[model samples]
Target: MTETKKTTIVLFSGDYDKAMAAYIIANGAAAYDHEVTIFHTFWGLNALRKDEPIAVQKSFLEKLFGKMMPRGANKMGLSRMNFAGMGPQMIKHIMKKHNAMPLPDLIELAKEQGVKLVACQMTVDLLGLKPEEIMDGVDYAGVAAYLGDAAEGNVNLFI
Candidate 1:
């Protein structure tokens, strides 16, 4: 019997392009029949946020953090050449011209392909992100869960 491969990714960057890259890799791995998991931590959790604001109660600091962080994947800025946030807009236009899927669409494709999307529970608590704030169909787990997956992965990546 052929063994199914496993791929684990640690998505640590919140940058739009960076997140897009992570999802693209995950989708590709899934297409190849590998069991894939994306462990979103710290700022990377922003990619899993719903665009609309949810009326969740929070502490003052948490509220401030929410206001400062990008609300969703589309709102995230580029890692470099941001040019005051115009870089992402420019990149989106170029992607459209190239008939490339946007980050949000890529995320949806990942879900359809049965890729495991996980939010770091510890990071969620530190960032004041409630389950209601994150998008649906994501698992919440701590480092141990991710480590278990990574330990058995044929390929492991940190992005």
Candidate 2:
């Protein structure tokens, strides 16, 4: 019997370009019949957030976090040369010109390709992100869950 190859990525950055890189790699691995898992923690969770606010009950602190953080991948900024948030826009325009997929489309493609998307349960609590605030088809897990996959994976990356 053959063992399934695995690829585990720890997505710890919120930058638009960084998140795009993570998803691009994840999707590529999945295409090669690897079991791909992306564990999103810290600011990386912003990449999995929904574009619009979901009607969910929240405490004062949770509400504050909701209001302060970027709503989704579309709102994520670049890691450098952001120039007051114009960097991502410029990059997006360039990507379109080259006929490359946008970050949001890449994310959806990863999901459609059966890549497992995990949100850090601990960070979710720390950031006060409600369940409804997250995108659908994501699993909520702790570090142990990520470690389980990483331990047996042939490829492990931190993005």
Candidate 3:
């Protein structure tokens, strides 16, 4: 017998750790044949834009400056995770070596695996993002719409 399952992830952080964690979980859930959905808002919106490139800080000054910069969501800037001494470089290297896939690719895979991707309209306006900025295969909707879907699922995670 095939038992269906539902899981929803409401991602609110734009940092690398949060983004990657969400992708990992989404991929795992899809692998298990569970229906998955991702709702992105605030800083999380950064991950949805196809044209929004994530800049790599080249030096200590740049990194420090980035720290002072107002991160769009969660009172934190979209900084990369430091994996001990190796830092973001090591993290990226390991991910590439493992063929773990990029966040955008994971998102696409999730969608291909029947995972729904939703972008919050309010965050769009707040961030001054246009409809064209969103990636292909994404649905733009208000928080209520996401809540409606989330309310029906067995699991909902805020990353």
TM-score sort, best first: 1, 2, 3
Model 1 lDDT per residue over 24-53, tens place? 999999999999999999999999999999
Best-first order by lDDT: 1, 2, 3
lDDT of 2 at 106: 94
Candidate 2, superposed: residue stretches over 4 Å from native: none
lDDT of 1: 0.96
1-159 in candidate 2: lDDT tens per residue? Answer: 488899999999999989999998999999999999999999999999999988888899888888888899999999998989999999999999999999899999999999999999999999989888899999999988999999999999999
* C-alpha lDDT values of all predictions: 0.96, 0.93, 0.70
Give candidate 1's error at residue 147 in angstroms: 0.8
Candidate 2 lands at a TM-score of: 0.95
Output candidate 3 Cα RMSD.
7.1
Using TM-score as the yardstick, the better of models 2 and 3 is 2
User: Model 2, residue 112: displacement in angstroms?
Assistant: 0.8
- The backbone clash count of each candidate, in order, is 0, 0, 0
